[model samples]
Target chain A: MSSKAFKQPWTLRTASSVFVIAWLILAAFPFLWTLWGSFKVELDFFSKADWRNALTGARTMAEHGSSFTGNGYSGAWVQEEFWRAVFNTAIVCFFTVAISLTIGTLGGYALSRSSYRYTFWLLITALIFRAMPPITLVAGYLLPFFEWNLWGILPTTIVVLVAINQPFTLWMLHSFFQKIPKELDESAKVDGCTQFQAFRHVIIPVMWPGVITTGLFSFLLAYNDFAVTSMLLEKENQTMVPKIASFLGTTQTEGNVMFAVAAVVSATAPLFILVMFFQRQIVSGLTQGAVKG
Target chain B: MKHKTFFWFILPTALAMLLFIALPIVSVITQSLFTPHEQVFKTVENCTPFKCTQSTTIDQEATEALREAQPLGRFVGLSIYLDRGHLAFGEVAQAWQSRDGFGDFFNKIGNLPFYRAMAFTLSYTFVVTPLLIILGFMIAVAVNSLHRHLKGLVIFFSLLPMIVSPLIGSLVLFWMVDSRGVLGTGLQWLLSNPDLSLKASTGLTWIMLMVYGVWHSAPFAFVVFYAGLQTLPKDTLESAMIDGATRWQQIRYVVIPHLMPLVTFVALIQLMDNFRVFEPIVGFNAEAHAQSLSWFIFNDLGGETRLLSSASASSVLTILGVAILLSPVLIRTWRDFNSKG
Candidate 1:
């Protein structure tokens, strides 16, 4: 496959190299620009006099006596109390992932082990549930949650997110469990262990890789959610994405766009770290459904 | 697995989906059929020496009590669905009767909120999906040709757009393209029009959003297609080369055919995803120029007045749209399952 016969012509090689380099710039430049601009004052970041001031941070230097200032970060994190949203986000993601994976693992394992036709119907139903946008369901939740005195709370939002996360979590884990052979658990069962005991002894140890991958996705869905978290959670209990959105509504009029800029960077940092650490698992999880189907 | 064991094992998740996903859908339909109770009005006679006058005033307590008694509101049947918000059947009929041509009719229909949203949603979904596929395949092919070490770095950077939250991604791009931001200023300079703003115009806004859509999603397609490329059959490629097939010819005949199934897989997932495009519209603040069904529902649900009935109708309609889009994949899955069984 690596033979000289398969080597590309120089013209084609150059063409592809140029295209890939252009794409890399397009993909990576925005985040880099935003991170850099987030440190500057709003004027320099969105410089009306000159765009180069954004790169040089000229007004940022004039205003704060430094080329780069943490004014936006301080303003967002302290003055606006963006840290509360961060705290709420952490709580939501933690609980949503924990609860979703718990029920999803048990259900997915059952579906994978069973030969019944009902399992097929369940997976198909999950597929349908997964396709419906989360926002559409928000309308139904409002009346009930208001009536039940459950609206505008972290726990309610967490339960809803976990429910919404279930379909994808179940599907991913179902496929992953299918990949693990039936023989191991069967052998344990033959040795006088009950079904639950067989699963506990034989399956749990080998399930970490798949579980971790699925858990990463669950974490992402819970973390990146804006539609459900915005509508269901109270202003005091808002998460990072919705908080950033709220910042836009008020902050833009107050001439404090830098706060939103700083908050966006703050929200994006964890995802950057997640991808950095779990690149392999993320890639595998994405292709898992495609390849298997 | 025995029925008892399986039932116990699946109960928790099944219950969650039922209570949350399935029930909300039913609730939405029910809410959509019912409109909020109208304020109760009481007529009072004011007696004067010269004349008597009658005044009608809203009975706040009575209205509140009525609403409290029946929180589901007054059942309006299908009126809400056919109203100006959801399906806009009346508006469509009016547009059709007064139409000068197909373009004029479509323009009139596009002015309706629901149809306006549908236009953008459908166009965005259709335009972005194939372009991303092509871009993704190109990246996959180019990266596959690269030295092994460079592949890792390129992939790491490539995943960033897709990995970040959509709101954050759009906001990041939105700021960069602000009239005074780098790309915005660059465009102003290049076109020699300092007044040009991407956010101010409908055509540019649509293009900007679709660009964001492709940038955010191409990585998923790239990763999938790259994996497909890894499993390419070397024997077929070698034979094609030996038979004097050019590189382009080999890619056209063999590589593409091999990757066709994966293309369909990526397309199905992207269609589902792009049809629900919501966050980007908010992040870009281009709601004035473009609206999606999700955004329409969000607008109805947000702020001082919840407009629950209107939002619910939109939800039911959006769910129907999703079902239509998803029908092909569901049908394919059913056929595959039937054949296997």
Candidate 2:
């Protein structure tokens, strides 16, 4: 190396730092803006006269005699029954994650442990299914579910979500399980335990962290989904996302956009906190798919 | 593991995938080939010395009887795929015979509902994929260079867009980009044109959708690349420095080659994701200007009419398109497996 080779200059360094920070702000600011706006009155948030009122909540405070108001929240929660959708979402996400992880853990463990050639095909098949848009599958389910009188119910949507989530869950957990050394479970088997017993006594504790990470993803899928839930669930059975969407469709014209706004904030609050706490898992879960692929 | 154990383990998922994923695809294909039976009608006439009356009435009994027998409707045999809503072969042939140039033909064809959605979906996919990759690579590099203490904060915020639901993310941006909102006003001020608005133009709306696409997905790329960067061997980089390779040269030759697999992985994933661009179109209320195949299916399945057959046709086409896009990955995976064996 030449002695005259210059270090990256302080000016360029500062510029790069500013650029990164600016990018982060660009990434995160819109949510914050909407979050703040959700507390204000419609006239202020979507201020026609001046956009600055959205930030300042000027008219909101003037009307309500406070800088912040929960009127939108009340309208969404009480009048719109947004809580129903929230409860439905919780049930759907919980069972979707639970059922998927239960079956997926066993399936993934099997796929990863086996030395047969079918494992490759199984993983490949799952990957292909993972690439498929769930809405397409929703089309298939409609006729049958309708025939079976299973359409438009929370359990129906939950089962469908679990099915839709199975591919990604299998693929993700398969990879995670593959990372665990084969020897631990093999030793358990050699120690006179059956395969299930080996997995239960030896691998369950080691497998939990990976399962949780994968469960987070499954929960995200169930929670964030709009296409399947909206199409599959009856109006009364709608989850938070589809409910918010239905609000936009039905209520947007009625000048009750604030209810939708409040609903969006309520929905986003949990995800915000989830990312804040589980940023590491979310980050790794995202990358693990790429790097391992 | 024993064969019985393996069978037991894979059965549930296999059944689920078979019933939901595989069955749906087959059902959609079958549905595409068939169309719902139309109402049977007959015209009856009554004649008299002074007046004659003719009436066309639906034969409700006959219609219901036929529908009961064939619940899937009448067999159309690929007619639906070739109809006005899908491939538009008739439209294409007419345009070809019109003696117009390619531009005029395209203009006429692009106005067709299915093609219009395809046009936007394809444009969104191609444009968004490259832009996000470049943006992600740049951000990954910058973040990789940042001081360790500040990295966590920046990363925490960066993941929010990717973490949030597509509907919420799009709604947040949609409000901002609305004419009355901050970004739209900011744009108007920048352009010194009070009339400027994203919603008023197709091009601007498309740009806004793509921008949302990039914002939502770039962090996936960034985090992947950042992780890839960590595994870049230090000895090779220092040796490159010793060989007088400039910083740009380092990235172009060494760093890029090291991250090539991850680049391909990200590209493949983003292609699949962007191909199914639905939520943003709905969130932005841009259906007037933009729609994707998924949106096409959603539209068909919803609304008062509930055109199940049409949605099924779109679903089949979408699956075919995904298969085409995914062939490369499958081939690569197969090759990798064979090499390992």
Alpha-carbon RMSD, each predicted model: 1.1, 2.2
Best by lDDT: 1
- As for model 1, its CA RMSD to the true structure in angstroms is 1.1
lDDT of 1 at A100: 97
Fnat measured on candidate 1? 0.80
I-RMSD for candidate 2: 1.8
Kindly report which residue stretches of model 1 are placed more than 4 angstroms away from their true locations once superposed. A253-255, B48-52
Candidate 2: lDDT of B183? 86
lDDT of each: 0.94, 0.89
Displacement of the residue A130 alpha carbon in candidate 1, Å? 0.6
Model 1 scores a C-alpha lDDT of: 0.94
Instruction: Calculate DockQ per candidate and list them.
Output: 0.84, 0.69
lDDT of 2 by residue, A84-166 (tens): 99999999999999998998998999999998888999888888898988887777888888888999988888878888899
